[model samples]
Target: MLSAGSLATLFENTIGPAFDDAHEYGYRGEFHGSNAVMRMVLDEQKQPDVIVSADAELLRTRLPEDIAPWDVVFGSNALVIAYGPDTAVGERLEGEEPWFEVLSEADAEIARSDPDLDPLGYRALQLFDLAEQYYDRDGLAPALTENLVIDPQEAHILARVEAQERAAAIVYKNMAVDHGLPYVELPEKLDFSNPEHADYYAQATYTTEDGTTVEGAPVLYNATVPSTAPNPEAGRAFLKFLLSNPEMLTENGLVVTDAFPRPHGPVPEEIVP
Candidate 1:
């Protein structure tokens, strides 16, 4: 299986073992940024039984029709400012002060993943722009951008925050929860959590240094079995189990609200509940 780095813990520690127990079959997973993994599949010809992506649109648009023609949107996540408790920003985050105000006034360095490599990275940039609009503050996004340190992986960004090597990082809420790090939740409008706010989210756009433009949208997780999967039967079985049990995602600190198991393209009917 190939998966987004954000899902490392859930897949490695829980889901993989649980599926093995339930169905008498186990699988190995290689986790990284969704785009990077997609590149591996396309460029390096590394085929996995299943491919799970953090960005729904990336799966829908980037992975060609001949490769992974169908995908199911199964889970969602929100962004948060995860910090080390010992840091100054962390101290204020625990207080009654508004999160955006604290972030705007803080002088500490902030870490983020590379927008070109990871969805979380681009989503962080989008969140900043949304925060600017939501807070009605001009130049807020630029102010936040002024102190960023771009790490190429979300795992590394969250690791830096946890180790206090950096004060904080904008990361997926599950990453903070998985690492047991302190975090302040941003507003749903800024965090890309509320699907009803899709139009508002679309107003925020981020252009990567490499020139790819990502428009803001709800943070959704997508999964599919590629056409050339080495173990297609196993892939289909696992996906069926996943769609049948949405509670596994909800238990892992993701937002698996009513808008889940939304199948796209020519998904196999047995896997689409």
Candidate 2:
């Protein structure tokens, strides 16, 4: 199993138990974050039986073409402003006020991952851009970006929020809830969770290189099996189990996506189902 930061707690506390419950029944799997999973797959170093990711795009971009084509959207998540009560900025933004104002303040500190490497980082940038439009603030994106110090991995951003090292951090809704952190909710218009707004959000793009741009939307988590997987049969079986077990996922604080017939690339036919 592979995932992003917030899901770590859920996987350990919830999903791990479910797998254990089925362990005697012959269900066994290991979970890791998307970054580590991707590196392993890309390097052809240690090909696990299964591959799941917090972002589907990683599979699209990193995996070899000969790998399985089909990718599934088994779950979904929304981003939110996360902070603790002890945080100086969190304390100040406790009421019905826009978080951008507090975040833009000169003394405020913010944290995020590098967009170039992590989808969370890119989504953070998109959220700021959306907030700027919603609030009519001209420099909101730059202001938020300027305040941020990038962590090497998306998971570390939560640590910064929990440690109160930063005033605020952009994180998934489930993460904030799981950590019991105080958060200011962004309007659904800006919260990328609503698929109806996907087209609108998707229209917004962030330029990575000088002239290259990528469209944006709510960050999506995806999964696939690699061609090099030593136990392709086991990978497919685990994928099937993950898709069929919505209750297991909800116990982990995940919201399953209704989208079906998940996209895939050309791979072994045996594992396609």
Candidate 3:
């Protein structure tokens, strides 16, 4: 199985352990960050029994309808400014001054993933745009990108921040807490965790090299099994296990959304329920 970091926690802390104890069947899960899994699914290289992603936009834009059908909105997360307590920016973020000002400093470094590859990457851009409005910084995007490096995934970005390689990085709230990293809290209005703010957040979008555009919203994580999957039966079974145990994910700092929302187009029936 191939899955995203959020789902990786779900499987590790809940699904994996539960499934292990059940022992009626056993499957090895290979966890990759959202971007990497999208790349793998798009390339059709490794047909894992399943694929879970941090955003459905990846599947909508990259994977063809024939490749997979239903995607479940298994959980939700929010973006937060994460940094180590010892870092310069982290220290300054404690104050009332806007975060962009601190990040604009000469020595500050901001880290993020590649937008074309990761949803968090695009979401990071959205957060910057929101911060631009929230802080009234005209050059926030360019300034934020000044010291940015593309980490492989959201978790990796937090790792860099914790290591103090970068002063701070925008990442999923669950990830920073999962790693026990100290972080400044963004207002709930700024945090992309509520559906009501969808329109405000939707104003932020990223256009990929292929000219595909992804608009931002509350951070929702999705999962799907491709039609080309080598083991559709196993994939369906695994998904069934995941959806049935939503509470298992809470311990890992994730919030499972309602049942899989229907996709824009037709989806595989087996995985839908």
Candidate 4:
């Protein structure tokens, strides 16, 4: 499966087994950067039956119309700081104080994914930029990024935290929940989980070296079938199975929509808005 790195934990335990039983095909999901997946499929000619993204709009923005004319907006997730093991710092990191204040402590060692390659990394910058304005701390955004240990993807950041190679990492809340890792929650205002705050979230932006501007938006997970899918029928069937299991999706740390969203192009009969 070509899925986002944030879903690494969920697919490990839930999707693979369910897919295997339903389609009698052994499947293992790969954890890659969401934006990186787009580059791989577009530039490197990588092909996968299913492609999942952290941003719903990316399907239209990054993929050609024929490649992925439609995509399903399946779930919502938000950012959190996943700290290393059971240190006092880790414990205090868990909603103990204003999250920004705690993170600003002298002892905090923050890690972030590479922004250009991964949405998480880009979103992390967005979070900090929003935090700068919301908290009214001048230069806070750049300060937070300063001295951060940058990894290629979210999973790499998680790996560093799990190995105690880093003190903390900014990652998706569901990722820390699924992995049973210690974490600190950010406020809903700062957390890009609610679509209601889309306008407010858009106030924050990050620009890449090439002058590409990445704006902030709610954290939404989208999935699509590539036109070049090896098994189009199986892909649709699998998508049906996933959308049908709203309860299981929640149990695995996703805030799934009550109904499958109507998409733009041909979709499985099972998908319903």
Candidate 5:
């Protein structure tokens, strides 16, 4: 399986083992930025049994129909500012001050993923853009931009925060939980997690290094088995297990929509509800 980095713990600790026990075979997983994983498939010719991505639209747009005929929207997440409680900035972040205000004044750099490689990276930028507008704070986005440390991997950023090597990082809610970090949750209007705020989120946009513009939308987790998968049968069984048993997702801090596990395109009927 090739999956988003934010889901590393979930796949490694929970789902992967569960599938192994149920199917009587072990499964291996590689986790990275959704875009990076897609690149591995396209550019490096790496074929995994399954590909699960953080962005539903990315799978729909980047992968050709023959590569991934369909995808299932399974889960959702919100952006958060996870901080190291030992850092100077972390001390102030524990106060009643607004998170953006504290971040703008902090001397330590705020860590985030690279926009070119990760959806969370661009989503963090979009969150700041929406926050400035929502708070009516002029130049707030640029103010916070003064201290960004963009890395290619969010998991690495979180690791830095955990080690107190970095003061804070912008990551998914589930990531913060998995890393045992205290985080400041952004409001729905700025977090890009609420479907009702889709229009508001759309106002914040980012252009990647490749010049492909990404507009903010509700964060969605999607999964699919590529046509070139090495183990198509195993991939289909895993998807069925995932969709039928979504409690695993909620336990890992992802929110499942009421009408979720929604299949699109030519997904297999057994996995479709």
Candidate 6:
């Protein structure tokens, strides 16, 4: 199985066990960013039985048509500013303080995943671009970009923040909560949580290092069974388990969906309560 790094804990602790309960065997999930995991499948010729991604459109980007016709949205997340204890900048990044300004402040260490490698990376950059419009801060995007030290994936950024190597970083809200990291609760305008802001957020977009256009949208977690999966039945069973046991997700700080975001082509009947 391949899963997004952010969902590593959930899959290992909850989803995998549930799968084993029904399948008679346990599988070790290879966790990586959505992009990296897909890259391995396509370039490295790795064939994971199941695939999950932080981006709801995981099946996009030229995934083999037979591998996955559509991706299903299973969870949602909000972006927030997470702070490590050792960071020098304190309450200024706290309540009602314009986070854009603090991010622009020199000496504020910002580590983010690489836009070309991790969806979170591009999302973080898009947040900066959105901040430019939301706060009308003309140079906010460039300033924040200048401060970022890119990691290969979101997990790496989390590791550095956990180690207190950086003061603050743009990360999923659940990540901050799960790690017990105090965070700046970003407004819906910035958090990428409210679907109502979808169009507003879309106003901001970022071109990845490879020049791929990534538009701003709410954070969503989606999963799918690859057409190349060795056991398509097992993949379907796993999705059934997760959609049925959403508590397995909510308990971990991820917001479970009441229903599939939308009918994504074909899905198992068991998945739709």
TM-score for each prediction?
A: 0.94, 0.84, 0.86, 0.91, 0.97, 0.91
In model 5, what lDDT does residue 106 have? Answer: 92
Model 5 Cα lDDT, one tens digit per residue, 124-231: 888888888899999999998889898777556798888888899999999898888999988889887888888898999999777778889889999999999878
- Model 3 TM-score? 0.86
Q: Rank the candidates by lDDT, best first.
A: 5, 1, 4, 6, 3, 2
Off by over 4 Å in 1: none
Worst 10 residues of 6 by lDDT: 87-96
Q: Per-residue alpha-carbon lDDT of model 2 for 1-273, expressed as tens digits?
A: 545555677666766566657644334344444555666667776667667676776666666567746676677777788876776787778864568777877386777766665566677888888878877889887887788777766655677778777777887777777777877777876777776787878766776532335566655666777677777676676666566677766665567655642556543445334
Cα-based lDDT at residue 111, candidate 1: 87
Tens-digit lDDT string for candidate 4 (1-273):
688888877777787787788776567677788878888888746778788888777556888888898788888888888887565457666537666766665365688888877778888889988999998999887777774678876765777777777778898888888767888778887889888899999988877654667778888888888888888766777676677677777887778765445465666556542
Q: What is each predicted model's overall lDDT from 0 to 1?
A: 0.84, 0.68, 0.72, 0.77, 0.87, 0.76
Question: What C-alpha lDDT, on a 0 to 100 scale, does residue 153 get in candidate 5?
Answer: 76
Per-residue CA lDDT of model 1 for 1-273, tens digit only, reads 888889998888778888988996686888888777777888856889999999998877778899988999998999988888898888988885787777777898888887877788888888888888788899998888877788777655688777788888988998888889978887888888878889999998877555767788888999999999978989999989888887877787887867788889999988877
Better of 1 and 3 by TM-score: 1
Instruction: Give the number of the best model, judged by TM-score.
Output: 5
Instruction: State the local distance difference test value for candidate 4.
Output: 0.77
**Cα lDDT of model 2 overall?**
0.68
Runs of candidate 3 exceeding 4 Å displacement: 33-35, 95-97, 257-273
